[model samples]
Target: MKEEIKKHLENAITSYHHYYASGKLAAYIPALLEANPKAIGACILDKEGHWYCAGDYEKRFTIQSISKIVTLALAIMDNGEESVFSKMGYEPTGDSFNSLVRMEINRVPKPYNPMINAGAIVVTSMIKGEDNNEKLERIIDFFKRLTSNEELSIDGKVYLSEKETGHRNRALAYYMKEVGILSLDVEDVLDLYFQQCSILVNCQDLAKIAMVFANDGVDINTGEELVPKYIARKIRTIMVTCGMYDASGSFAVRVGLPAKSGVGGGIIALSPKKLGIGLYGPALDDKGNSIVGMKVLEELSRKLDLSIF
Candidate 1:
């Protein structure tokens, strides 16, 4: 089974590599432009501790928006569900992930969901910390535990790039602050949010983290409950509904797994109690998801009957 899965992953990577040309690097973030647009990788970790990997699985990239899931989980664990949800809704917004239009139109200007930039910023504020440094430390620590990689840390270049050029996110944070949705200092919240987005990871790291979710919040090897069962369940539900930005609905029909995509060309996906998948391809479609990564997952899902729906 290991050999078979590895072969399939290799085939998928080969078949979808050309799709990189159909997409472009996430040029808006200067640091992301440094990624090898042609690099495509995948890893699958099943419940029995088997790992099948192919392509450029070792290439590191920023965790990007994928950090939202961890941050949301940490916030819920820090504050009760009721407290967390009071700042953001769970509904999906068809708009772009970074767009602030919905906030402007709504009578109550809170972000529609934590998956989007506005909502993620608000959720980051909910994380208990005395300062941005402490909050960022907590977030990085959570990520390290989730991936079982104590070496996990931020990409300083990417963090600096995000902090300097993330004008849109800054706008969202300020608006939420003005509307009374955020009680914390806006710059501090944005700093923590940007810092979280810049945490470095690769396909293998992402797969290990996804495996925890696959096991309903428990570490597969150690039997440690990394996240409470209810919180893990809620995170998966939100990923299914909103993880792929505006392209989530179509991704659901085509792939049928709970997954999240990052602009850093990484995607984390899982089939409950079956397997966890991690993919990376820096070239992005219009929706900011990894184009090659999406194609690879679709092929794998079809071949392995891995779709949830």
Candidate 2:
């Protein structure tokens, strides 16, 4: 099985490496534009804790919006489900992940689902902490436990870049505050949000973290329960419905797994009790998803029969 998976990954990487050319790096982020647009990578962790990998799997990139999943888990773990839901919603917004159209036009009482930028900021505010640093520490600690890697830290350059160019995010935060859904100071919450999005990881680290979700909150290697079963289930559900921004529904129909993508061209996906996948391709398609990364997952899903649907 291991050899088969390895051969399969090697073939997929070779076949899809050219797809990166059709997309471009997330140039708007400024810091992300420096990445080699052609860089592509993938890693898979099976249920037995064995790994199969290809391409630049060891190269680190910002987790970007993928960090929202961990923040939601931490918010739920600390404040409970009801408190977190009260501040943010669980529905998918068909608009772009960064779109404030729905939030402003509809006057949404809560940001629709924690996956979007608006919702993610609200979710970050709900995380229990005395200050921005404390909140960020909690998140960092949780991710360390999830991946069993304590050396993980935020990419300071990416964090500052996001903080500077995140005007839309700032507007979203202020709007949430005006709607009575946000209690923390707008900049403080946005600081934590940016810091979380800047968390540094590579394809291998992402697969390790996804493996925890694949195991329903239990560490696949240590067999320790890091997240409660109920919280893990709810998180996966949200990932299916809202993870890919506006393309989530299509991704769900095609790939049929819980997954998340970041503008940094990283995607983490899981099939329950089966396998966890991680991929990075700095080039992004129209929906802000990794072009080669999505192709790799689609090919793997078809070849491996990994769809949970």
Candidate 3:
């Protein structure tokens, strides 16, 4: 089975590698522009401890918006569901992930969901910490545990790039602050958010993290509950509904998995008790999802009958 999955993965990479030409790098971050736009990779971990990988699975990239799921999980662990959900709704916004229009038009002005930039900033503010350093430490620690990689760290260049070019994010944070949705210092929250988004990861690291979610918040090898079952369910539900930004509805129809995509050309997908799949393809379509990664998953899902729907 492992060999067969690996063979399929290799074929998928070969078939979709040229799709990179149809998409573009996430050039807005500047640091991300250095990524090999043609690189494509995947890694899969099954519940029985089998592993399969192909292509550039070892290549590293920033976690990007994928960090939002980790922060949201940590915030729920820090503050219960009620407190966390009070700051943002769980519904998907058809607008862009970074859109501020909803906040402006709504009477309450809170972010629609934690997966978006505004909602993720609000969730970061909810993290319990005395300072940004402590908050970031806790976040990094959580990520380390999730991926089972103690060496996971931020890419300093990407962190600086995000900090310098995040004007739109700053506007969202400050607006949320002014509207009473955020009680914490806006800069501190933004710093933590930016730092989290810049953490480095590879396809293997992402597959391990997804495996935990596949097992309903428990570590597959150690049997430790990393996240409570309810919280895990909540996170997966949100990922299905909002993880793909404005294109989520179409992605749901095409792939039918609980998954999340990062602008760094990575996607983490879950197949309940069966498999945790990680894909990386930096070339992005207009919606900011990895175009090659999307095609790879669609092919795998259809071939393996892995979709939940």
Give the winner by lDDT: 1
Per-residue lDDT over 1-309 for candidate 3, one digit per residue giving the tens place of the 0 to 100 score: 677788788888899899999999998899999999989989999999788999999999999988888889999999999999998998999999899999999988999999999999999998888888898999999999999999998999999999999999999999988999999888888888889999999999999989988889999988999999989888989989999999889989999998999899999998888898889999999999999999999988888888889
Off by over 4 Å in 2: none
* lDDT (0 to 1) per candidate: 0.92, 0.90, 0.91
lDDT of 3: 0.91
lDDT of 1 by residue, 12-96 (tens): 9998899999999998899889988999999999999999999999999999999999999999999999999988999999999
lDDT-best of 1 and 2: 1
- The residue pairs in collision within model 3 are none
Off by over 4 Å in 3: none
Evaluate residue 17 in candidate 1 and report its C-alpha lDDT on the 0 to 100 scale: 97
TM-score of each: 0.98, 0.98, 0.98
The 10-residue segment with the lowest total lDDT in model 3: 1-10
